[model samples]
Target: MSPSARRRQEAGGKTRPGSPRHFLRLDDLGSGEVETLLERAVALKAYRRTGVDHANLIRRVLGMIFEKPSTRTRVSFEAGIYQLGGHGMFLSPDDLQLGRGEPIGDTAEVVSRMVDGVMIRTFGHHRVEAFAAASYVPVINGLTDSYHPCQVLTDLFTWYEQRGSISGRTVAWIGDGNNMAHSWIKAAVLLGFELRLACPEGFEPDPAILEGGASHATVMRDPRAAAQGADIVTTDVWASMGQEAESDDRERAFGAYQVDSDLMAAAKPDALFMHCLPAHRGEEVTAEVLDGPQSVVWEEAENRMHAQKALMEMLLA
Candidate 1:
C-alpha cells in the first residue's frame, strides 16, 4: 500500500470494507487511484464525444450543497451526473435546514441517507470534514477555503489528457497561495511531480502543507523563476470568492505576479497555460495570454465534468 493509504488506515480513515470513500483531499486517494481516475476520465470524455451511452452511475443521486457561489462546479456536476444516468439536486444554504442553524453533520447525515453522494462548496474546510465524518455516503470537496480538491484533480486530469504522464514534469503556480495552490501541493507530493509556486510573501500557501511536499515543491517570489522551463504554467484569481472586500489590496499586492506574456515566455515554448476560471482578464492574466494559443482554460473547465464523473463512480462503488 502507498504511504497515504497506510496513513489513512492508521487514522481509522476507513472503518469497514463497505464504507464510503470520501474525497476531502487529494491525498485521500492513493496515487494508483488517481491514475485510474484520470484514465477513466479520458475514456468518459471520448464516450461523450462519440455519443456513446455510458450509464455507470444509473440510479445514483448526488446532493450538491453550496455555501458559496459557483458556476463551473455547479453546472459541471449537475450535467455530469445527469449524463451518467443519475440526478443531481442543488441545495443552497437557504434551500435546506442548514440555513436555519442546523449543524453541518446533521444536515450531512440526513442528506446522505437520501443521496448516493454529496458534494460541498463551502468556506471552511472543516465544515466538509465534519459533514464527511457523519455521512453514510461519499462526500466530495467541491471547493473550500483551505483546499479545492476537485478543481486540482480536474487540473491534473487535464494535464494527463494532454501529455501522457506528469510524473517528472514541472508545474508552475503563479498566484495567491489559496485553496487551489494547497491542492496542487498535495498532488505534487502524491504524483511525483515538481511544483514551483510564486506568491507575494504573505500570500504563500500554508506552511504545513508546503512542508509536506518539501521534496517536490518549492516557493519563490519571482513568477518568472517559477515559470522558467515549466511544462505547465497555471494560476488563479488574486482575490477568490469571499475575499471581495480585499480586492483592492490584493490587486496592489498581486500586480507584479500576473501571468502575462513575459511570464509565459519564461516557460517552455510548448508549455500550456491554465486558469481555474471566472478569470479576471486584466488582473491575474492578460487578454493576450488568456486568449492565446497556449491557453487551455476552456478544455480545463470541461474536464471537471469528466473527472468528477470518474470520481463519483469510484466513490459510489
Candidate 2:
C-alpha cells in the first residue's frame, strides 16, 4: 500500500477503503463528527491551558497553497501545524508552477508525494476539489469564494467553549451573503441550529446552500428580526477581498444592516458576537459591539489554530 493508504488503515479506515477523507466543506463531516471535532478542540485547548505537550503530527508535513491572501487563515494553519509538531510549507501562486499553466492534477500528484496533507485557499472551490481528487494524501479547503468552512469550524468550537451545546441555539448572521454565510448554512444543517441571516435585497446567500439548510435557516432584510433572542450574533465584511469595485454601493446598501449594539441587544442578554476578521469597525459592525464584553472575536480567532490542530490530526495523524 501507498504510505497515505497505510496511514489511513492505521487510523482505522474511518473512510471507505482506498479513499482519503477531505475536509472540503463543513457538511463533509457528519453531525457526530462535528461534535467530536468541537469536543476535541475543547480538549486540546484545555490541555494547552494547563501547559501540556502535544506533538501528534511529529515528522508530518502539510502543504498550504494560497491563491488569495489572508491574515488569519495563513497564520492559524501555520501555527497549528507547528504547535502539533508538524511542518507547514506555505506556497503562493508565484512560487508554484501551477500559476504558469501546470495542470492542477500534476501539481497535486507531486505535492502529495512529499507532504502528508495539503490545504488550499483559493478563489475557486473546485481547485481544492481537483487537488483532493488527484492527491494520495488528505486535503483541506482553507477557503474559497463558495465557502470558508475552517473559519466556521473554529467559530463553532469557540461557541462550544463559551456556551456548551449549540444544537438548539439560535445564530444570527448579519451582513453580506458571502462564503462565510454559506459555511454557516452548512453548519446549521449539520449541527442542528437556527440560522437567521439578514442581508440586503440583492445579497441573499447562494440558493443551493440556502436550500440545503432549508429546515433550519431563514433570511430576511431586517437585522432586528434575525437577531431577536439569538444565542450567537455573527457577520463578515460588507465586501470581501475581490469585491472592491462594489465597495461604495455595498456600503450604502449594507449600512442599515450593521450589527450595532442596538441590533445585538435584540439577542439574548448573554449572546456572543462574532466576525471573521479583519473587520471594518464602522462598516459591517459597530465598534461598541465588536469590542464589547459579549464579543468573542479574539478567542474565536485563536480557536482556529486549536480546532485545525484537531482537524489535521484527524486527517494526517
Candidate 3:
C-alpha cells in the first residue's frame, strides 16, 4: 500500500472518511473557495499558454476510474495531470473487481491506497458517494447520473474568462433537464446566478434538486422565453448517456427546444453560447448557432483541463 493510503486509513484529517476534502459535488466547496479556484484556473491557463513548465504535482499519481466512455474527460484529465507533472492511471470497471460486483467502498479503499487522488466518472451518484465515503484520498466527481460537476465547473470558468463573475448573469438552459442541468442548478444556488431552465414537462429537473435552488432558478416551458434577455444560452443533448433507449421519444419531446439562430437572437447581443458537448447538431442545437460568433465552446472545452488542474491542486496541495 502507498504511504499516503496508510496515513489516511490510520488517521482521517478530522476523524471522518472525507476529512481532507472531496470534489464529489460543486457544493463541496464554498463560494470563496470557488472564486479562488476559478482565479487559479485562469492563471494556470495563461501560465501554460506561454509553454512554461511547472511541476507542482511532481511524482504524484491520480487514479481515474471510468464506468462510462468519454472523449473529453479522459483526454483533458490525462493531459492536465501530465502537464502538472503527475501520472494519471486510467481504470475501468473491467480492470477491477467493481465490475465483478465488489462493493464500491472496498474498491475505493484498495485504490486510494495506491494513488494520490481518485476521479470517478460513473453511472450512479450513489456509487461515487459510496466510493468517496471510503476513499483515503480526494475523490472528484468526473460525472455521474445526477451531476456533471466537473464539466459545469469548466463552463463557469470559461464564462468568467469572457464575461465577469456569473453571480447575477442570466443563463438559459435549453433541452433535457439531465445531469448537466442538475449540476447547473447547484451552481446557481452557490453562485447566486439566475438559471432559467427551459425543459419539457416530463423532462423537468428533479424537483428536489430545483427546490434547493428555487431562489436562484426558474423552470419555464418555452425555450425562447428562457433565452430572452439572457446573457448566456446553453444546452445539452436531449438524451444523455444510458438514455439512448429514449432517443426517439426525447428527440420528439425536445425538438422544439433547440438553440437555433432564432433562439440565440432572443438572448443578449453578446450572449455566450455553450454546450457540454458531444452536441448533436440540428438536435439540441443548430449547426449555425454552434459554429457562430458567440460560441466559446472550444475554449470552454479546453478550460476543462485547466480548471481540473486547479481543482486537483486545491485538493492535493
Q: After superposition, how far is residue 22 of candidate 1 from its true place, in Å?
A: 0.1
lDDT against the true structure, per candidate, is 0.91, 0.90, 0.90
Lowest lDDT 10-mer window, candidate 3?
Answer: 11-20
In model 2, which runs have C-alpha deviations exceeding 4 angstroms? 1-17
Model 3 residue 296 lDDT?
A: 89
The Cα error of candidate 1 at residue 26, in Å, is 0.7
Off by over 4 Å in 3: 1-18
My TM-score estimates for the predictions, one after another, are: 0.94, 0.94, 0.95
Clashing pairs in 3: none
Candidate 1 lands at a TM-score of 0.94
TM-score of candidate 2 to 2 decimals:
0.94
Model 2: lDDT to the true structure = 0.90
1 or 2, greater by lDDT: 1
> What CA RMSD would candidate 3 show?
3.2
The top-ranked prediction according to TM-score is 3
**Residue-wise C-alpha lDDT for candidate 2, range 137-170, written one tens digit per residue:** 8899999999999999999999888878899999
Residue range 1-317, candidate 1, lDDT tens digits? 76533433454323344457799999999999999999999999999999999888888999999999899999999999999999999999999998999998778757877788899999999999999877777999999999998989999999898988999999999989999999999999999999999999899999999999899999999999999999999999998988999999999999999999999999999999999999999999999999999999999999999999999889875
